[model samples]
Structures are given as structure tokens and as C-alpha cells.
Target: MMLIVTGYMYVEPSSITEFVEDLQKLAITARQRDGNLSYDAAMDDPHAGRLLIAERWRDQAALTAHLHSSDTVAFVGRWGDAMRGEILKYDARRERGLMDE
Candidate 1:
């Protein structure tokens, strides 16, 4: 099954820039990981410190590999200081979808 990972980060109103930069690096790294379908990030409410991350992986194993990758380590390390909340990981299922190739 394809996995969709969404995360919400509530920052301390400060460190927004640093957090975003770190997330950008992380998104790129996630996309580079094997079996990763997509990885993207966005800032919520314009100037708001809320950050949202979306990811798609081939399967749980692939997602696990991504979590254990060096990029993840660096991502966490780089943003460790500015992190202010918990990261929630959820398992998802697709009921309807189509793609043209």
C-alpha cells in the first residue's frame, strides 16, 4: 500500500526561517531516498510559524528506510533547536485514484 505522511509543526513564532530551511533540505533528501514517491513542504497561513510536510512512499519499509536515512538524522539535528511540537505519523490507504502515463 502507498503511504502518505503528513506532519504539522508548531514553532515558537520565531525560528520560522531556520525551520523552513531545514525542512526544505529534508524534503529534497526524502525525494532522493529510494522508494520515495514524493516529498514536499509548505508554510501554513503565510507568515505563520506552522509548517506542513507531505510525503508519499512505496510502502512501510520504504518509509522506514527514509526515517533511518542520514538525511533524516541531519534534518532532526539541524532543526532540533527550533522544534516545538510532536511529529505525527499516520498510515493511509487510497480508495480512489488514477494516473495517466
Candidate 2:
């Protein structure tokens, strides 16, 4: 089974640049983790201080391991009221490309 995570987070506008730098680091590390299919983070709206998050994992075990990974903790720990987010996860059932024939 595959797992997908998606959400948005708001960071202090002043921290956007640093946040992006840190996020890029996290993304690079996460992509190398076991069972990680894909991971990405990007600014959804800089003016609104909103950033989008998307992740795909091979399975629940993979996602769970990642949740407890040191990189994850460090990234999260950096958020001391400097960030607020709403995230959701799902177990993919059927999915298809919008452009698939």
C-alpha cells in the first residue's frame, strides 16, 4: 500500500527564506530515506506565508519510520511558534494520472 501526505504550513514571513533553505535540506534528506517514493515542499503563497507539503511513501512502516527520523524531528523542532500547519495523510487506493490515456 502507498501513503500520501499533503498539507500547508504558515511560517513567519520573516522566516520564509530561512525556512525554505531548511525545507530544501529536509527534502533532500527525505528523498534518500528508505521507502520514500517522493517528498517535496514549496511556497504556496509567499505573501500569505503559506507553504505546501507533499510526500509519498511505500507503506505505513515507511511513513512511521520517517515520522521518527532525526531529520524530521530536527525540522519540526525548529518550529517554535514560528510555524503553524494542517497536514493530512491517506492510504492510496486507486490513482491515475490526469493525462493518462
Candidate 3:
């Protein structure tokens, strides 16, 4: 099974640039982790202080590894105070046809 994570972060207006730089670093590190399918971040067009992140992993084990990875830990330690957000995860399965839906 695949895992998908999506969320929005509310950054301090004055810290948006710093937050984006940190997010880019985090995304780069995360993409290099084993079983990482994708990691992406984007700014919300209509919302000045909001940034969105989406992540995909191969499985629960992979996601767990990422959660405990040093990169993630260091990112949190370095930039945690500059933003606030919620991330939600979901188990994903591919559907081949409408009949299967």
C-alpha cells in the first residue's frame, strides 16, 4: 500500500522566505530517503501566509522510517518555531476500473 500525506502550514508573514528555504531543504532530503515516492511543497495562491506540502511513500514502514529519519528531526529542530501546521496521512490503493470502485 502507498501512503499519502497532505497539509498546510501557516508561516509568519515576516518569515515566509525563510520558511520556503527550509521547506525546500526538507523536501530535497526527504526525496532522497528510501521508499520516498515524492515530496512537494507549494505556496497557496490566495493565502499569503499558507504553504502546502504533499508527500507520497511506498508504505507504512517507509513512512515510519522517514518520520524517524535524522533529516526530519533536524528540520524540525531548526525550523519548527517558524511555522505551524497539521499533516494528515492516508492509506492509498490504486483502482483499475469503475467496477472496482
Q: Is candidate 1 or candidate 3 better by TM-score?
A: 3
How do the residues 18-39 of candidate 2 rate in per-residue lDDT, one tens digit apiece? 9999989988989999999999
lDDT tens digits by residue: candidate 1, 1-101: 88887877776666777777777777777888888988887787446688777778888999989878887877777776766554566666654556633
Candidate 1 lDDT score relative to the true structure: 0.75
Residues 60-88, model 3: lDDT tens digits:
99999988988888888877887688889
Question: Which candidate wins on lDDT?
Answer: 2
The candidate with the higher lDDT, 2 or 3, is 2
Which candidate number would show the highest TM-score if scored against the true structure?
2
Off by over 4 Å in 2: 99-101
Error of 2 at 67 (Å): 1.2
RMSD (CA, Å), candidate 1 to true, equals 3.4
Candidate 1 stretches greater than 4 Å from native? 46-48, 85-87, 92-95, 98-101
Residue 32's C-alpha lDDT in candidate 1?
A: 81
Query: Which of the predicted structures, 2 or 3, would earn the higher TM-score when compared with the native?
Result: 2
Badly placed stretches (over 4 Å) of model 3 are 45-47, 95-101
